[model samples]
Target: MAEEKNSIHEELIDETVATETVEGEAVEASEIEGEETISLEEQLKIAEAQTKELEAKLEEAENRYYRIQADYENSRRRARLDLEASEKYRAQSLISNLLPAMDNFERALQMEVDGEQAASILQGMEMVYRGLLEALKNEGAEQIEAVGKEFDPNFHQAVMQVDVEGFDSNHVVEEFQKGYILKDRVIRPAMVKVNQ
Candidate 1:
């Protein structure tokens, strides 16, 4: 009887240990599943943060690209306009230099002549003056008429203001030096006497 009681007690203790072991294993499995879910959530959060950072970087890069494109376009437009303006005013410097020579020629042709030889020389000078004037005309240069016209500061410089007979007030009486214009730009203003 004692041995049988001992066997029954040993069986009960073994069954209780087995039941405790099973419950411990079930608790450990649940803890492991919860840990895995937390780890997945953390990984997803990290991935989303990284994605946002990359999107911001992409937008910044695109904005920089657009700004550089606009700068290039503006630079190209400025260069083209500079080229056109250079072409438009190509002959201005040369014409400016030749104006003094033309003035000297006109002075020479104004001298009094005494003989046939002097008259022939004067005729030759006149022909040359006409040719030079024609060339200037072809190049878009023109003489501004100053005599018997209204004296304007835009085209004439009044060196002397005087009372004159049969002339309107604020009109030009006499032009001492001629003025010239290249296109719409005045090269020199005419030196003139204005009637008051």
Candidate 2:
């Protein structure tokens, strides 16, 4: 009977040790699972940060693209306006070159002729002057009326001021050189004497 009791006591000790080992293994497994959950949360946080960074870069790139597009539009508009202005004044230089020749013609026409040959030459010159005037008129150019008109600085340049009979104050008394208008723009202002 004593030997049987000893054997029963040893068996109970062994069973208790086995239960402790199993419980320890379960605790270790739970710890491993908790670590895995924490690592997953950390991974999610890192991914969120990277996504936000990429979004910021994308917004910056979009803003840069918009700015470049606006600049290109403005440059194109400016170039178009410049081209239009150039077209509007295409004949300016040619008209400017003809003014000195017109002045010479006027001076020659004023000379007195004393003989038949001289008078015939003068008649031919007058015809040429008329033809020149007609040609200028056809090109949208016209002489500014300065003599006996109001002295406007836009069309007349006052070179001399005088008190003249039969003329109002601030009126053009005599034109030294004729002014001309090419289209709507003034090519030259008339050099004139103004009445005081």
Would you list the clashing residue pairs of candidate 1?
none
The residue-by-residue lDDT of candidate 2 on 1-196, one tens digit each, is 4565456555444433332235455333323434332343454465556666877999999999999999999999999999987777677687789889989989999998899999999999989988988888877789999999999999999999999889999999999999999888899999999999
Q: Number of clashes in every candidate structure?
A: 0, 0
Prediction RMSDs, each to the true structure: 18.1, 18.2
Off by over 4 Å in 1: 1-67
Return the number of clashes found in candidate 2. 0
13-52 per-residue lDDT for model 1 (tens digits): 4433342235455333323434432343454466556666
Which portions of model 2 show Cα errors greater than 4 Å? 1-66
Range of the 10 consecutive residues with the lowest summed lDDT in candidate 2: 28-37
Candidate 1 at 101: error in angstroms? 1.4
